[model samples]
Target: MNSPDVSALEITSSQACRVALRGPELIIEAANKAFVRSAGRDGFLGLPGWEAFPELRGQGYLELLDQVYRTKKPFVGLKMPILFQPSKGAPMEEHVTDFIYRPIEDGSGHVTGVFIESYDRTEWARA
Candidate 1:
């Protein structure tokens, strides 16, 4: 059987708001345009997840990421409420979203990173 094309997967992921984080610190490794816009900050690329969104520090997201990294498990969240700033110095806005945090493993079967994908559903939720 022929293997599926990896590029196709990359292409599909690129269309969504997605980010890849590496190491236990969850340093930002890569992100798509949508993810960058969603973050609403500059200079987040290379920063730890906590540093990237300081406002999210107490929101349990870091703990969730830690659990996923430790257990090599994936987390799926549906219609979750999130508050974030649209830009620096902007007031926080509430958004409902669906998201996934998938563990990334190396050939040795050790978890190495996390792949996060999110879909905004605020309008749908408000309608």
Candidate 2:
């Protein structure tokens, strides 16, 4: 039997709602199509995570990211509730998702960024 191709795995992973944030400020470095759709907009690249999703502030999400980055440990949130603002001046919408915050480390073992992945579970959670 043959092992799976790493590039193929990357492609599959990119299909999910994923985003990569860099530095302690958590600047949005990269985001996938599913992430854009889930965010309900684009142009997130280059913005701080808090700026991209202001509603997330004071919600414990940012703190969680900070914790993961600081400790270089991953956090798994199952069926977590998140409030998102689809657009400017829009009301916040509640969403439930399963999310993971994985710390990205450099060659020297210094945490430099975070890899975020989430799966929406709104309908299932509501049902």
Candidate 3:
């Protein structure tokens, strides 16, 4: 049997609204164009989610990430409030979104990471 190339498994999905968090530390892996717009930051990769958005630590997002990482279960959050800084040393602005945290498994079925898909719902939430 011929082994497939690992790069072939990579997701270059055109979902338009996607973010990838990997490892037990929940490090940011990739933030797509839509995700960058929603997150307000283009450079989150190599930083842990908590480090990127410390404000979310005690806001239940960290715990939720932990749950998904440990339990390997998917989580869906609706109209969740998030504070994002557009740039370093900038003020944090609140945004609302509906998101899903899904587990990514290797070919052997071992959970390896979490994939985040979210839709901005701030305008509707403000109404």
Query: Runs in model 3 with CA error above 4 Å?
Result: 1-16
The runs of at least 3 residues in candidate 2 whose Cα sits more than 4 Å from the true structure, single-residue gaps closed, are 1-15
Give per-residue CA lDDT, model 2, range 50-93, as digits (tens).
Answer: 99888998999999999999988789999999888877788999
Q: In TM-score terms, which candidate is top?
A: 1
Looking at model 1, how many pairs of residues clash? 0
What's the lDDT for residue 53 in model 3? 76
> Looking at model 2, which ten-residue stretch has the lowest summed lDDT?
1-10
The local lDDT score (0 to 100) that residue 91 gets in candidate 3 is 88
lDDT of 1 by residue, 25-81 (tens): 999877877877777766887999888788777777889999999998789999998
**For each candidate, C-alpha RMSD in Å?**
3.4, 4.4, 4.3
Q: What is the C-alpha lDDT of each candidate?
A: 0.80, 0.82, 0.73
lDDT of 2 at 13: 56
Ranking by lDDT: 2, 1, 3
Which ten contiguous residues of candidate 3 have the minimum total lDDT? 1-10
